[model samples]
Every structure is written in structure tokens, then in C-alpha cells.
Target chain A: MAFYDSLFDSLGLREWCGAGDKGGPMTMAELLAKSKGTTATEETSALTLPFPSLDNLHAACEAIPRTRDMTSGVENFFLSIKSSLQFVLDPLTQPLSWLLDGSIWLFIAMPWWLLIGITLVAVYWITRSRASTILVAVTWLFLAFIDHYDYAVQTMAIIFICTGLSVLFGVPIGIAMSKNDRLQKAVIPVLDMLQTLPSFVYLIPLIFLFSVTESKLYGIAIILYAIVPVIRLTDLGIRLVDQDIIEAANAFGMTARQKLLSVELPLALPNIMAGVNQTIMMSLAMVVIASLVSAPGLGVLVLRGINNLELGVGLVSGFCIVILAILLDRVSKATLARVDVSQDS
Target chain B: MTANVKVSIKNLYKIFGPAPESVLEHAKNGVDKASLLDQHGHVLGLKDINIDMKDGEITVIMGLSGSGKSTLIRHFNRLIEPTDGQILIDGVDVMTLSADDLRKMRQADMSMVFQKFALLPHKTVLENAGTALRVRGFKAEEADVEARKWLDRVGLAGFEDHYPHQLSGGMQQRVGIARALTSNSAVMLMDEAFSALDPLIRTDMQDLLLELQKELHKTIIFISHDLDEALKLADHLVILKDGEVIQQGEPQNILLNPSDPYIEDFVSDINRSRVLRVRSVMQPLKEAASSTAGNVDYNDTLEDVISHSDGDTTKVYLVMHEGEPVGTLCMKDLVRALVPRVPSEESIRS
Candidate 1:
């Protein structure tokens, strides 16, 4: 003990670490260390597992292989490929971001009552049910009364853009996948990984790749998270097209393009619509996570409340989101159900 | 049956497998389906098929399932490309035609009716009927008009707006027939077209097809597993077994003399009197065989001739064709021809 103290004193590490002054609650590890013998255990614990510092991980990192890193070689590989990825992704995806930005601006600029009225009208058109339309109207009016009307509109805009883009890009990819076996086999694993990933994990890489200020960051994150369903369902819908119908189309000497547009697509529309419904729901669920990347929506208010530990703000915003989710779900579910009835029910 | 062949499928062979081209030589050298499948992992879909479908005649290809009858018909449109074949529709070699020409030929000269009433479920009955014309790039108005005319003719005038699922099986098939008709093609391929309907409905469909064929004289290639259906409708009958043509000729001739044992077995269960025509039993002109009591038309069924005779064994009637005495038929000969020609038990035992 004297030698250790002299060594600490000689090194002048006592001033830096504050010798013999333990802090905070004892972890199970620390308790066991204390039980081992208070003086010996603490000194040994201090030397071996001292309270965390900025370079704590680095201290023992040499014992672990770089190849077996916490952040994988795959992660590094993706980072390395970022420039090439952006080369293909940027200008091509610029139009999408612009469209989303335009929609967001439009929604924000519109009067709150007008957006609510449009929502009511849309719900009525889809369901043709008075009860459902009135419910949708009340929900919107409630959101407006709470002064979260603009926030709701922003959320709606993002959902619209993400869901629209998902269907637009996803359907064609699904069709191409169905048409070629080799491509389907190659793409399915990527889709599986995308879907099985935790929602927050998607935001991480997207955040690093694109700046937080860019709308494309959240837009891309939401799309990646929500796109799987539409692609799968479209592929399934087309594949589920009756073999006899396909044969009949072939017998009619219809062109490949004609067959797809006239027969296959019309037949697949109901399934594709159902896919869109799922995509929309997912986009809405992703809103809270998306708020972390500076997405302007009700999710932003929810995040703010959490950051500042304001219970009232968090609970109210969260309630508004729930109401929005329910209203959107009902309208879309009814619409999808109506489509299914026309097909085979 | 006529000399003017509308569609001639010549030397057709369809080998079905991953590597059919490699096994073509072995198949052409008389390798059977089973042996080819066992030895080479290839199954023969159609083996050296040859058929000349006559213009304005109902040519029915009769076979049980796996007989390549459907496969053979599909080859006419090249829907299932034959491993080796020549499909000549009119004087033009169909195999030699480019894709555009083939599409043109399909639009202009040929149409098909499927077994399952393969009407587009989303399309209304009228729109479904008009699909062929629309595919051929006709304006909607003109196509609708053409479709309306055919739909009326097929007894579906009142159900124009009904979807396929709303229609009965018979009505759906009528729509299928109408769709084929509206294409205004000279050749119609009906692949077991009425097989999916109920028995009564099937008979009605068959009668409708016959009535339409008589008036329009469209060259119809009908496929069926039922020998009765084949005999009832076929002017020329083609029988197939295990992807090869067993026999093909005039339907009456096929009933009278099935060359193969498989065919004999098929014919054994048939009721002969309804199927045998007067021309089949008629003899060369004999004054003794001629009768003034009634003149039987050459194409009349033997049952009709028998009814006219009223079981008078002495009655000998002149067989008339287009107001000309083509032959004479005696009651005895007619009775003898009507007898069921069941193969003896000894032959089966052997």
C-alpha cells in the first residue's frame, strides 16, 4: 500500500484520478470487489476497472482484433462505397427530395381547415360511409383545436411522399424481380435485412450519409423502412395471377407490354393497394424515429418534450399521433377493403 | 373435311425438358416418352404430330389427358413452341413468319376459346368480347359494335354489362364463343371449350357451336376427351395417345374402323346408331336397294334412316345428297352397320 501510494505520488496521478475517493453506487461487480476485502478490492478495482473516461474503450481495444471490431468491416465497406453510392443516388434522388419538399411547403402554407376539409372529403370518397367521414372530420378538427394542425399536416405530407415513392419505385422493382428468378434470389436477402432491421438502425447509417438538415435523410430512411411491403405484395399479386388467365392472354397474341398493363396490372391493383396501406402505416410509425434526423412533424414536438423532460408536451403530442394513426388506418383499411370486394372479396 | 387446308401442322415434335434440343435426335429415332424420360431426363410432349385442318370443318382432336391434343393445338399458335415442326396456316409457313406477322395472323385469321372460360374478370362481358379487336388496335366504338353483334348472336344480348363471375358457366362460355367470333377470324381454336360446363349446358354449347359453324363455316379445331362429344361435333376426328397421333379421318369412318386397340377400347363404349350417318351404310347404286317410299339424305343419321324404314327389312331407299342419288341403302345393311362391334373376349385374353 505504501509503495503504491508512493508510486501514485511520484507519478502525480493522485491529483488527476483523486486517489482513494470512490464515487457512485456500487455495481454487482463493485459490491463483490468490496466483499472481497474493502481496501484491497477497491484499489484493485480502481486499477483494473476504474470509472469510465473518454478513452476507456481504447484502453483494452488492443486485446481485441480490429477485424472483429464492434463496428463491422461491412460497415466500413459501406462507408467506403458512400461516394460511389452518392454518385448514383444524389442527382437521381434529387427530384424525389424536391417533390417531397414541394409537398411539405404546400401543406404548411395551406389553411388548417382546408387540409381537414380535404381529409374529410377524401375519407368520404373512399368509404362512402357517413359515420367514417364524420369520425375522420372530428379527428382532424381535434388535432386543429390542439394547435397541432400544422404539425399534423407536416406528418401527413411526409407519409404521403414516402408512401407514394415506395409504391412508385417498389412496384416496378417487384415486377422485375418476379420476371427474373436470378434477380429475385439476389434481391430477397437485401429486402429481408431491410425489413428485419430495427427502425432506429436505419436512421443511423442514413444520418451519417446525408446531413441532418437535408429532407432526403429522413425521406430516405422512411422509404427504406416502409418499402418492403409494397414490393412483396406487388410481386405476389402478379405471381398469383391465374395461370389460365396468363395462357388466355398469350393465346390472344397480346404483346408483353399489353399483357402487363391491361391484364396483369388491373388484376394486381387490389393487392398493390393493400401494400400501399401497409406502407402508409409503416411511414407513420417511423415518424417518431425520423424526428431524430430533424424531420418537421408532430414527432419533432414529441422528441422535444422527451429531451426537456416535459411530460405534458410528450403525452399530448403522443396522443395526437395515436389519433392520427387510427384515422389514417381506418380510411386506408376501408379503401383497401372496398378494392378487395370488387376483385374477389 | 375438304381439300383446302386452313392450318397444316407438319412433322411437329415437342420435347419438354431443360435440354430438349439435345434429346431431339434420340426422340426422332423412335424413342418413346417413358424411355426418353428415364434415360435422358426429357419427356416428349408431342411426337412427330401431323394434322391438316380443313377449311370450314370442325376438326376435333380427341384424347385422354396427356395425349398431347392440347399441346398440338397450342403449336398452331406457337404458344408452346415445338422442338421441331412446321406450322403452315394457309400457304404461309407460320414458323417462318416474324413476330409482327405472327401477331397479325393471330389477330386477322385466328382466335381461341379456352376450357376455363378465360374471360378477364375485371372486364364486363361486352368489353371481354371486344378484347380481341382492341388488341388488334381497333377503335373502341367499332370493337364494341362488332362485339355487340356477336354477343347477340351467341344469345348474350341482355348480359352485356355483367362481369364473367356474374354469368353462369354456360353464359360465360357463350361470352368466350362471342369473343372468338368478334375477332372475325376464319379459324377458331376451342380447347375443350365446353368441357367445364354441366352436362345439359355442355349440350347446349355444342349445339350453339354447331349452329354457328354451319352458318359462318369457320374452320374450328375443337379438343375433347369425351368420345361422344368428339363424334357429335367433329367433321374430321383426330385421335391421340401418349403425344402421338393414333388415327385421324372422317368421324364416321373413325367410329366404324378404329385401327388401334386403344381406339377400339374408346369406341366400344359408344352408342353407334346415333353416330353412324346414312352415307356410311349406303351401298353403290342398286335399283333393288332403292325405294320410292322415302328418300334419305346421305348425311342423315342411320337412326333416321331406320325410323323412315319403320323396321321393314325389305325397304331399300335411295340415299340423296344435294338432290342427287349418291348411293342406295337397304334396311339389312343399315341394321348390320348399326350393330355394336365389340372386340371378342379372346382377343383381349391374347
Candidate 2:
């Protein structure tokens, strides 16, 4: 009976009066009377011979055009538009190249040891732990000994810039998405596409539009890659806020903007901060990948060692990246912990 | 008693769905429930709710879950807009208020406490309490000062810096209450505000609310599912069921005579005499009562009157509203009042 029901449903025959009946075909009047809860004593069955086979079902289905054809057409249209955008953007990419070089040079010229010292102190102050401070200091010293400080600093600069941009752009987008369902629906597919696409795939079109020497090339790529976490976190944070709290805010006569700023945002701060942490981590991950395009960092050193077969250089560069990752992770985690503690008491 | 109604709601209907207005339009044309359901998956959250919340009175709307009690109160504050109705606050149609005006009305005239306490978890107790004032444009220092005063009023003076999650359920509710009161809104809407607390704490919170009401004289609209809480707190009680008002009257009247079988069933288990108090059911005391019975306090319960009297010819003393003697009762009358009636054998068997 279930199989027959499925067959009828698949064939779109359920809309007809005679379908879905197990007691053979019945007249429209008989079906209506049965639906109305009237008893029908007389039973008249109509048996038709030469039932249509599965091949006929398949043939009928093939006669109808599928929705996929329209989707593919839309996809091709978008592909063309993207390529056209890349062509227009190429000439504007050169000026950004000088800015990237200048920023890298500035970091390279700084007294690398002093930079490491100040970072250690800041980490210590933020985390408020002697062990974390010592670990940060030791990691920097080890990187300096291996002569990977310059590359590590370059990577740090990219992460700092990208993470900052991600927070700036992602938070507001998240807040907007939380407030408006239509905006959320519109933005979510884009976020999903960005998140699921391979990290290397992001650089392909970006490489076409922006020169590898441009700081904005890596900047834009890192932001695109890292922005999803912050946006998601912010949205989740605001969405997770108790509905009763929002209602309470409304009852208090808070304007929509006031409520978002004062109540919803404050309650969602932890989630947003967590998103910031994730964004930073993602930025660091993408910075290494950006090194392939001549963006300077520990990744550049690692790539150099791999290409030249210098085992010591690769290991040293890898160690520097780990130290940098620890520093950023510790500082952000400490900030988040402080937030939670302050909220508690 | 002659003060004009502060809030007047007429035929309020709040239906939740995309096409609520269209569905409501069909509903008014005598569309059957099934047809309405089929056309639009409309859930009648609130239906034809009419109420007048008098100035300085605590009106309690009581119902089981999904009975539209919460939705009805939400309509007055415009937290949830009614599909079709007129809600007048101080003679202004609340439904027609512009966004800015509505916000101003909320900030100045109404505040609400939620059952979950809804204290901002990120803000300190002081900041949470001061939020309403801050949003209404008070300066930081001024808001803090006012917030401290309300926090002190709610008995949390020393815990201003503490956050909401650090506080117990009752304490959190106190913070919520303080926040609502800090706004100094004439109308305070509390949605099951103390229902989440332990029984003892709930009683304390209830007492605190009564004390606050005594001093503030705010027009309070309190929503609760508990009948006892409603009876204890409300000046006027509105009983709702399935998006409709089943009964609305003074607590005393409703206790004495429930309007429908549903209400009768609802109040059937309630110990009426315990809630009624000496003031409600007291009669005139007679001069001759002093001869046969021991003198009982005029304010004592009937149970107290029964337990203290020891003699076989025990006479029940009647307490008058005023100081003068009015009437007396014997043991026979007291027994009749205390006993619960049982159905007859024939009726039970049938």
C-alpha cells in the first residue's frame, strides 16, 4: 500500500479523485461520500488491464524539463560577471603593491628584539599570568635565534590587519543579519560559499584582479577567508540572546537602535568576541597560503626552505609561525576570559 | 475611584502569521476555525481582549500556557501589535503612535519585568538597573545615582557591581524589578516575574512588590499562571483560556462566584476560606457573645476561632468591619461552613 502511495505521489496522480484508494477505483461521488463519513454498502470495482510499466513512468518524467537548467544558466551568468569585474579591477591593483612593500619594510626595519619584548609584556599584562608571559618571551627568542623574526613579523602584520578588518565588517553585518531575516537569508548563502570553497580557490580570482606584490591582495583574500567566523559568531551571539530579554527591552520602550546597542549587543558580546578570536586564527592560516603569491611572512621562509631543500630553515620558520599563533591565541583568549569574569561579577 | 482609566483595550486581536490581517478579516466574516486554519496557518494568540487597567491598581491576567495572557498584556505596551483593536493609554491610541512616540511612551509611562529576569548578563547589577534611564537620555552619573537608589530600594545596595548570573533567581528578579521601577513608569507590566523562583522566595518577592506598590502606587499589569499568586496580588483579575477572556472581575467576586464551568474547575481546588480573609466574609458581632464563648480577636481566622473554643456549648463570635458588635455564630453554623459537600449515591452512580 505504501509503495502504491509512493508511486502515485511520484507520478503526481494524488490530485485525482480515484488515486490513493486501496479498494480499487471508485466514482467521484463514492469518494466524496466516503470523505463525508457516509457508509456505502454497494461495491462496484473497475479493473483495467495492461498496466503501464516502470519504463513508461521514466518516459513521462523525462518529458518534463528539470529546474536545474535554469540554475545552470544563472551560474554561467554570474561566472561571466565575475570575470568582467576582475578585468576592470586589474589596473587599479598596482598602486596597492607599493603600499604592501612599504609596510613590510617598516616592520623589517624595526628593532626586532624590542618588538618581541614589548609584545611579551603586553601578553603578560593581558593574560595576567607569569607562565604565559615567560612562554611568549621564550618563543620570540627562539624565533630570533633562528633568524625568522622578520618573516614572522610580516605574517603578524597581515593577521593584525585582516582580523581588524574582519571584525569591523563582520560585526555590523552580523548585527544586521540578526535584526533582519531577509538580510540573513541573502547573506547566509554567500557566507556558506566563502566558507566551503578551498582557501587556494580564493586566491585564483583575487590573483587575476590584484597583483601578488599588492598588500591589498593578501589583505582582501585573508578578510574574505577569515570574515565568516566573526559574522557567524556575531549573528549567533545576538540570536542566542534570550527572547524575553529583547521583549523586556521593548517593554522598556527602547528604540530599535538603542535596544541593539544597549541590550542585544551587550548580551551578545561574548559570542562576538569568540568570533573575533576565530577570525584571527583564520587570518593567520590564510597568511601562510598568501605567502605563495610573494606575500612576506614565516610562510615565505618555509616556502624558500622547501624549494632550496634547506631542512633547518623550514623547521625554524615553522617554529616561528607556531610562536606567533600562540601569542595571538593567548592574548585574545585572555581578553575573552576577562569579559566573562567581568560579566559574572 | 473616579480617576479615568489609564489603559483601555477594546476587542484586541493578535494573530501570529504572515497574513494575519487577511485571516482576521476572514475570521470576522464568520469563517469556521478549520477553514481559517486551512487558508492561513493562523494561531489566534489573543482574541477580542477588552480590559481597563485603572490607575494605581494591580491587574493580574491569569491563564495556563498558550491562553493569550502574556500576549494580551504585551499588546498594551506594543511589544506585540494587535491584529485588530484599539488600545488607549491616557486617551492616546497606542496602536497609532509613531515609532518615536511609541518609544517615548514606553520610556516615560510603561516598563516591564520578564519571568526570566532578562537582566543584561554583560552589565553589572547597577548598569542593568540603570539601562532604562540611560536609554531615555539620562547622563551616566545621573543614571548610576538613580540606579543605585532603586537597587537599594530592592535590597541590593551592596551588590551594585555584581553581574546577573552571579545572583540567585530571586536576586536576579529583584534586579529586574529595580530596573523596571527605576524608569518610574506609571504602568509596570510583569510577565510571570516571580513564577520562576522557589515558593518561599516567590512569596518574599510578592511581598516586596506589594510594599513597592504601596509606596509607588504604580498601575501594574501582572501576568501569572498561578491562581494563588493572582489572588494575592491583583486588585482586578482577568482569567483567559484559549485566546479568549473567560472571566474578569474583582478577586473577591470571582472567588465567591466563578462565571463558567472552566473557571469553576480552575478555582475548585483553591481553599477559598483561607484566601477570603476575615475582612471579606466577616459578619456583625452580637453583644450576647461574651457570655458563652471566649473572646477571639476580630482579625483571627475562622480556623483560629474553631481551635481556641473548648466548651460543648461553643459559640462562634462574629467580627464586624467596624468596631461595633453586629452578630454571633454557634458551632453548628461553623461546621456547615467548613464541611465539603459530597455527591449523592444516585448521582454518582449515574
Candidate 3:
């Protein structure tokens, strides 16, 4: 019935193979116990199994594991650990929900004019460039004229909180990695995987772990997708500082904390700021994908358009997201240019 | 003279490798640097280095690149720990000090100037100069006042608010010197502090250092590759080769009577007439020489005496220390001193 049935019989494996007998599935333990008695007799052929013959063996023996069984086993293991994993992570991640909810409420509840005025002033103060401030103001007004103001504000609130959390946690991890070679060697591969993995894959696990109603369900997905660049750039920035200057800091008898705060951090700021700009852009990208999990904002409209075949809704929402991205990117880059002293002669 | 010893390095050995302690015996047993590296995969950084630096004098360590002169100076501040050695600074064993005490010593007792002028790029000149004081927890205003005084003294009065990158190489190094001075440390370690400057600026900095030394009287350890700079600045000169001290003493004594062929080769091409002072060449006299041409200061170079005598080989001049005659110099001895001693024929063949 199977390609491997006769070959297995010639090898004196017939008894273990469940040959010519239809049977239900059996556990791997019972299969191993039956196979342990297999021996080559005088009439048995001394032949090896060919490559990729495991599927044929599964067809011949009902006791052998099928590919689907292997996948199910993995799923079962994950399910076994899910409750314990949730028990530990739920407490640690609870505050992220509070931060996300609070910011979204505040951004939407503010008077429209007040929000616009305050945002423009903040951008102007950060960049000290009139061109960047004007770009942000115009982008916001266009979105408001099209009735996309509330959605844009919600997206901005998410990006702000996610980027802030990324920096708050990412910088210290990067600093610790820079100071220790062992820690750096261990962390670099993990960061590489996080950066290269498809952004949608981050949401798959978080969705299973947290309820879709909680803000942290999408918050965790966005933070995980966005945090990689800040960590990598912060580590690289500290490593790139001039060795001569580090020696001078040591020569001044600076304590470890003092050297890091006064010398290393100031020198590494421009690189970290560049990383922050990238993080903000990444957070906006992930927020759209996270709208599949009921995340509020422009992404929700984009999802609605896609699901319902509303070309105008999807196209306009996509255009609005692009506008928000450009505004954030330009403002942050202008601020970085101001902070980078080496750009001057 | 022994009581005046400010810093003493005794039997120091530095082997650089993964397992330096495992190969320490090989380095200690007089193994050559090359063989040690080839046999045990270790670099011999320094070997049995011993030198006593005196207080209120500049000890210039001169060597070619890779001679470990830079490595040697860092040991004083414990920046690079010696594999095996005892360093005594102000009569305290530097190796025995705790982390806190060592930081205190570095902050209050010793300061350094780097060859690359390692000023912070973001900070203004005033802030860079005051870094040492600020690190020691001095108030920002207090540190600024101290930093400003030294910056003014170094002729950087109006450039306090300018960033380091905005200054020239020489001016940045002046900020480095001002930083060291602001700390008011008793000992200064200058690692090729003028090597990065232009030739003209280098000369000006040398003169500035000598002038400052007259008033400060700090025990300074200077590292340089230039023999002319060494002869000009060093009260005690130490020459190194292959990370071992070849000869060290008064610069004039080392030049006049070089004991090794390496030392002989190093001093042969120097402008002897300009660098050799009258005090080193003159014959001491209890009374004034008869028929002396005129008076010459003991510190005058042979070039000065040559111009003063107008190339008169027969005329003799009394060497004056302060106002009294201490010795006499003749043009014949001056001419003889101008020629470097020929190396032994056997030394050349080897």
C-alpha cells in the first residue's frame, strides 16, 4: 500500500511497521517500544532508507509522526506554557495600557485649536526651523478639513507613547550592551531577528496573549516592532565615540556614572536622535497593521476600506498616514541637525 | 638628591596577552621580546623598567614609536596596570591604592595633556577646561572661575565660549594645558603634547612650557620622539629602546658620553653646537682665567659663545653662574665637543 512497506519488511521491520494492517494513531512512546525489538535476520536485506523517506515511513506505519502531528505538538507545547507566561507578563505590561489610554484620551479631548497651537509651538521649539513648523501645521489642517482630525490625533498619540517607551527602555539596554562585550554578543542576534522579521509576525503572538479590547494588545505589538533601531544605534553611537576622549574622561578621575552621563551620552545624542526618528516612522507603520487587532486611528479607516472595497476611504487614509510620517520625520531630522555639532566647521 | 625622588618605578614588567600571568616567568627570566612573542604568543611591553623622577624637574622620556614610552607614562596614573611592578608616587605605592584613593590622586595630585588634544567636542572651551573640577563635584561657578584664570594665562581669554572644534590644533592643545593647570595638580603628564602642532607652533609651545615651569615648579613627565625637544625641555632625560631603558641621566651627560651604540647613533645627527650648553663643556675654575675675552653665562649654548667670540679659537671666556665666575670655556674645547665620538669598530660589525 505504501512505497516503503516492502523495503521495511525486507529489513525485518515488518512487525514494527504495522504492515498490511490498518490502525489508528499511536503515541511515539509505543512506537519506540515496538521498534526496539527490530533485528536483521538471515533472510533480511541490509539496506538504508533514502533521503526524505520519513514521509513514506509515516504512510507505512501508523505509529510514526506525520508533519501535521509535529506542528500540533508545537502548538500543544505553546498552549501548555501560555497561562504561566501570561501570569508573569501581565503585571509587567499593565502600565503600558494606562500610558496608551491616557495619551489617546488627552489628545482627543483637547480643543482642536488648542491642540494644533500647542503641537506647532513644540515642533518650532525643538527644531528652531520655521519651515518644519509650517509643514506640520499644514499637514494637520488638511487632515482636519477632510474630517480625519480625530483619527490622525489618535495615531499621533500612539506613536508618541510607543516611541517614548522604546527610548526609555531601549537606551539603557543599549548602554549596558556597550559596556560589556559578552552582553553585546548575546543581544546582537536577538536584535537582528527582531529587525528582519516581518512586522505582522509581532502582532500574531501579542494578539493571542492579550485581549483585543485592551490598548496594550496593540501597544505591545507596536513597541516590539519599533524598539530595535534605537537599541542598535545607541550601542553603535557609544562605541563610535573617540577613544582619546574616553581616556581623557578617565584621566580626570570621572566615576562610571559621571563619565556615562556627561561624556558618553552627550557624544552619542545625535546618533540616538536619528534612531528615534526611525523608531517613530516604524511605530506609525506597525500601528496600521495593528488596526487588524482593533487599534484606533487612521489604520482603522484603512482597514475598513480594504475590507469593504471602499477605494476612496483606503486611498485618502493611506495618504493621510503618509503626511503624518513626513511631518514627524522632518521635525525630528531638523532637531538632529541642530544637535550634531560636527556638522559645523 | 635621593630624598627629592618624586616618582619611582621599580622592576616593572608588562606583558600583553590573554594569559599574561601564565607567561610572566618567561618575561622575567631575560627572554628577548621577539622570542617571547614567537614562543608564547605574548608581547613584551616593558622589561624591568626602573627610573626615579625628581621633584620640581621635568623628566623627559624619549623613544621611537613602539618603544613603550607612552605605555610607561600611563603606569604612573594607573591608567594601564603594570603586569608586574611597584610604582611609588610621593612615597605611596600606586599599586596599593584603592579605587577611591586612586581617583583622588588623579583628581588632585596628577593631571595629563594628550597628544591629540582630547577636548570634548560639544562643550565650550571654558566647560572643557573645567571638566576635572566639575567631575570632582566643585560647583559650576567655582570651576568656571578657576578654568577662566588658566585659560586667560594660556592666552585664550576671549575664546572661552567657543567650541573645541572651532579652534586650531595649537589652540586646542592650549586648552588641554589650561585644563591640566586648572586642576592645580602637583604632577603633570604630557604625552607628546606638542607633536601634533606645526613646527613654528611647536617651538612656541616649548618656550611656553619652560616659562611656566619656572613659576609652577611642578614635577612634569614629558614623552617625546624628537631629540631636540628632549634636549631643550628635560632636566633628566631617559632614553628607551625595545621597551627597556638604554640610558638616563642629565641630558648633557647622556649626549657627551653615550655608553651604547644606539645612543651614539641617536645623538650623532643632532645640531651639537646649538644644544650643548656652556655649563656642560666648561672646565671649572676656582679663580678667574688670565686674559679672558669676556663673561659668558653658564647656561649659554656653544652657538651663542661662537657668535660672541666671533670664531676666535685662541680666546677664552669665564663662565659666570649668577654674578660669580664658576668655570672657563675656550674655543678649542668647543670645537672638540662639536664632533660626536666615533662608535667602536666592533660595535659597528655587530
Interface DockQ per candidate: 0.45, 0.42, 0.53
Which candidate's lDDT is highest? 3
Over 4 Å off, model 2: A1-99, A343-345, B25-40, B283-318, B322-350
State residue B46's C-alpha deviation in candidate 1, in Å. Answer: 1.2
- Give the range of the ten consecutive residues with the poorest summed lDDT in model 1 chain A: A57-66
Q: Which ten residues in a row have the lowest lDDT in candidate 2 chain A?
A: A55-64
- What digit string (tens of lDDT, one per residue) describes model 1 on residues B1-350? 43598889888999999999999999999988999999999999999888998889999999999888888888888788889989888868888988988888887788999999889998889999998999999998999999999999999998998888888889999999999999999999999999999999999999999998889999999999999999999988999999999899998898888787777777877788888898898887755542356788988998887777788978878888999877887788888876656664524324
Tell me which residue pairs clash in candidate 3: none
Ranking by DockQ: 3, 1, 2
TM-score of chain A of 3: 0.89
- Give the runs in model 1 whose Cα sits over 4 Å from its true position: A1-97, A126-131, A308-312, B1-3, B288-293, B312-314, B344-350
The positional error of residue B78 in candidate 1, measured at the CA in angstroms, is: 0.6
lDDT over C-alpha atoms for residue A226 of model 1: 92
Q: Model 2: how large is the Cα RMSD against the reference?
A: 14.6
Task: Candidate 3: list runs displaced more than 4 Å.
Answer: A19-54, A342-345, B343-350
Local accuracy of candidate 3 as per-residue lDDT tens digits, A116-174: 99999999999999999999999999999999999999999999999999999999999
Q: What tens-digit string does per-residue lDDT give for candidate 1 at A15-113?
A: 654532343344454467578876532334454645443223222222222323434677889889988888888787778678878999998898777
TM-score for model 1? 0.87
